[model samples]
Target: MEVGQVLHMNAGTGETSYSNNSHLQKKVISMTLPIIEEAMTNLYSSTSPSSLVIADLGCSSGHNSLFVVSELIKIVEKLRQKSGHQSPEIQVLLNDLPGNDFNTMFKSLPSFQKNLSSQLEAKDAGPYFFSGVPGSFYGRLFMKKSLHFLHSSYCLHWLSQVPEQIENNKTNIYIASTSPPNVLKAYYSQFQRDFSTFLKCRAEEMITGGRMVLTFIGRKSEDPTNKEAPNSMWELLAMALNDMVSKGVIREEQMDSFNIPVYTPSLSEVKSELLEEGSFSIDRLEFSEISSSTYYNEYNHSDVSEIAANSIRAVAEPLLVNHFGDGIIEEVICRYKEILLGHISQEIIPGITNLIISVTKK
Candidate 1:
């Protein structure tokens, strides 16, 4: 299936839209702040570009997208102030698949700019330009040696398409406890190919000394079957679909043929790919577990479960609609909430492992 043309979060600022349900992603950006700050500082110190051309690939439309850009600008402005040098003009490119809700994001830009302007009104910051560039990041999206800084958060783990060989991974949309060993191999191979292409594309697009800070969901174990509910949101989603199938709400054929286009790589796998790609040098690589309940402290257990289900629904509903039509959307989400409520226990509220890597163009 052509995943790019169909895959996107639920559009607009509705109840299930990604814009309102992206608290987990927002928390991730907040958690990784120090790493990003360091990466931007290193890039500026090395290149000191007069015009900072920044691109955020897979920058889905939402507050999180603007949050990332604003943080980078703050870092650079601080750097220029410290050095007493002229501030550089900033060019921002927000990229995603063509199906993204760019209209919603674009409409919010005036407010974003207003807030940014007020914050920097008294400070020495350069002109900030914003534009949307819609496309996949697995290939070239910019001219050669054009980007000075790059960032993507919670995006790289999404494969450009599902692994072709996973047809036999029945009754499951992603890697699950019942998935065969071959399923793991297929997913890894797809990740290798996609990630290599991503590295190569960015290497060509970025100038020497350009830096990238990427953070995406991953797993601590090499065994895909060992991933818990927090990391394998798709697995829970598959369970919900299977429940519908049992109730005759969805066909078995639908469940059997579908596979999520995502892979949760181990840290070693990511490092290996970077080393093999041979274009970028790893400056800082780290893995950490953060609670999925980030920013949900005031929410009760039931509220949290619904929010969690909505988050997954926002990301997966488009894929489901493309494959199964819109008939099953509401029922599947309802069932997904039940599944999440059941799986959530009184334990530590399992944290999702995210790998954060900062690399420099060689």
Candidate 2:
């Protein structure tokens, strides 16, 4: 399914802003830049490269896109300047689902470019270029051995499609409690398969020794025993969907077919996949759990509660609309808001319940 086309409208929480995400990105980049520099150096072994191609996979709309891409370029430019080599032209590719809000991304590009241009003018850096490659990163987006550096944050783990078993099981059981034993198996199996494909695709697209840094959410549990295990946040999300279903806001069938496309990988799992894809060696790997508090911060009193609920809706409403039908969406979203607010105000602080895993490719 397309990114926001199927399950949740904003399944990836793609609406997250750069300001809210600065801390996470900063942390990931600190661990990633060195790895990228080393890989790029290896890739350009004998030649003095003129332009650096940095692709940000799973790049969503809003300021985060501009923020991350600009940051990546700045780092690369700084490195080249220090090395006394004329900076290579920068080619930045922003990727996301086919249906992503390109208007926001496109509109922001000029400003991003203007900022980069100003910086280059300051350092006597050469002209830099930027573009958007709209497609799923689970598949190839570039020609063989083309990209010099690739950066993906909180994006690599999304499977290209929901597991077929889960999709087919819609009529067999309720969406809430319905996933067959094979749902997660199918999901993980596809993840391994798609991830292997992604690695292979990147291996093909990235020049040998090219630099690729990836940061994504991971599960604390080694692996889920089944599709419904507590370790899978998708399960909690599914529960939220079921609640909507119970309230007649969604169809049982819709719930069955809808699934969040994200899959959190364990550190070991990622290492194994990277190795299987071949040619890439992990230069660095760091995993840290972050607070989920970011989820609740968007709302203030009514607005805060409104968005805290809407944030989940941003992800879920799309799915409900796709499967259950759009008519129930507003109702579902409203109910979702009320329920989430009640829980947060009454039960728990909105916090991140995820681990960040950053990997450097050879």
* lDDT tens readout by residue for model 2, 1-362: 55534421242324433323334444555545555555555555545577777788877665466666676666656667667777677777777777666666677767777777876645666566667787766678888878877778766655676666566655332222454667657767877988898888888888655677677766555644323212333444455567877877566776666665656666778778777876677666656544445433544656665654544555445555655666766665565566556655664542332333333445
Tens digits of per-residue lDDT for model 1 on 188-228? 99999999999999999999989999999888887778765
Report lDDT (Cα) of residue 198, candidate 1.
Answer: 95
In candidate 1 the C-alpha lDDT for residue 330 amounts to 92
TM-scores, each model vs. reference: 0.96, 0.79
Worst lDDT 10-window in candidate 1: 342-351
Q: lDDT score of model 1?
A: 0.87
Runs off by more than 4 Å, candidate 1: 121-124, 229-231, 292-297, 345-349
Deviation of model 2 at 39, angstroms: 6.3
